[model samples]
Target: MRIARTVGMVMAGGMAMALAACASVVGSTESEVQIRTNPDNAHCDLSGYEGFAASVETPAAISIPNVAAPVTVTCRAPGFRPTSYTLNASADGWIWGNSALFLASGGGVAILGALVDESRAAGKSYAEEVHYQLSPDRPRPVRARSRDGGTDLNLQAR
Candidate 1:
């Protein structure tokens, strides 16, 4: 009788552990955040009112593994304005199939930020001044120049 009771306790513990592992695996699946931009390509000049840009489905503002109902995302850009909408999905153990849309301008801003940093580090006033030089041994030019007045530096290829 003692041996049987011990075996029963062990089996119950094992079952509990298995259930916990399954719960963890089910919870590990994360909710997805999708970002879509308009224009589909980069544009140099964004001064006109016709030009549109924006960001949608920002992951920072929302929560993952959402137990509640679906969430809505709304944003605006220069040409495009703010609009509100709702997303509907069943409250299942896993929340899947989510989407959002935005004007293309937000991504352009991000690209512009990176370009600005590159220009600053390369000592170039404009991005165009930075160019590549090639040699016989090295097919690619690894140096950049300053269009305006600034120090020039040589970049080495990896």
Candidate 2:
């Protein structure tokens, strides 16, 4: 009987240590942040803007360390307007749940097993990345008119 009790206690201690290790491994206390241009409209042009700038902010920025990821950037020349958009970051790196373990036997052993299983199963982790962009708008130029029976000069801006 004493030997059985000692074995149960040792098993419980091992289970506790395993649960703690799993929790620490899955948790993400760090994150990254950066800047990038919109991949879809890369070829589009916005050369005629007066000024252009972009910025991004997030709640995790203050909480997580080393959050640096660029979403997208758009710029325009003088006489142009500004445009901006937000992007949601992906959460592929997060671990949402835990694995379960079962050990069969008596009433007292079952109760201790329940405690270990509950603690291990309750673990969770979450992470996400967000993106944003800014751009200036430029209106197309108007066509010129002809005078004095001269030829009309209409050149399309490329």
Candidate 3:
């Protein structure tokens, strides 16, 4: 009878461990990132995931899903040259905790949990904050002395 009770307790413990997904439980499938520009209020567009697109003004916060891919951010403002940035995902540190879970739950349950996290991309994240700097579209004009002693206007793009 005591042996049977011990077996039941062990089975219950295993079941509980199987349900503990390190990344899903401790981390998130999405994270919020702050976007800022040298001059505020630039129109920014974010894309990468299919059917997922967002637009916002600079100096804002955006919540993006965690994926094993890159997200592109493009910004534009009047009189300023447009700029684009690629946001890459890095592995979340919490995902590594699954290795520790192996010791507690044995290899099988821990591996299962890790696979679930991998499928859901629960262990990837983008940078917490991103900043962009845009240059002016118009260039300054320079005055040069011509051969006839007349002033000439030289338009240069710098």
Candidate 1 lDDT, tens digit per residue, 10-117?
A: 986564433332323343322343433342221111111123223333222222233222334353433443444433323333211110001222333334333432
lDDT of 3 by residue, 1-158 (tens): 99999999899777657555778877898889999998899999989764568899989999888862578889999989888988887888988877877776677777888888887778788889988998888887766768888777576755
Superposed by TM-score, candidate 2 places the C-alpha of residue 22 at a distance from the truth, in angstroms, of: 3.4
Q: Please list the C-alpha lDDT of all candidates, in the order they appear.
A: 0.32, 0.36, 0.82
Off by over 4 Å in 2: 17-23, 38-136, 140-158
Show where candidate 3 strays beyond 4 Å: 1-19, 103-106, 140-158
Model 2 C-alpha lDDT per residue in residues 17-40, reported as the tens digit of each score: 454333234544233433333332
Pull out the clashing pairs in model 1: 38-104, 53-105, 54-103, 54-105, 133-141
| TM-score of each model, in listed order | 0.32, 0.32, 0.76
lDDT ranking, best first: 3, 2, 1
Q: Lowest-scoring 10 consecutive residues by lDDT in candidate 1? A: 94-103
Best lDDT goes to which candidate? 3
Better of 1 and 2 by lDDT: 2
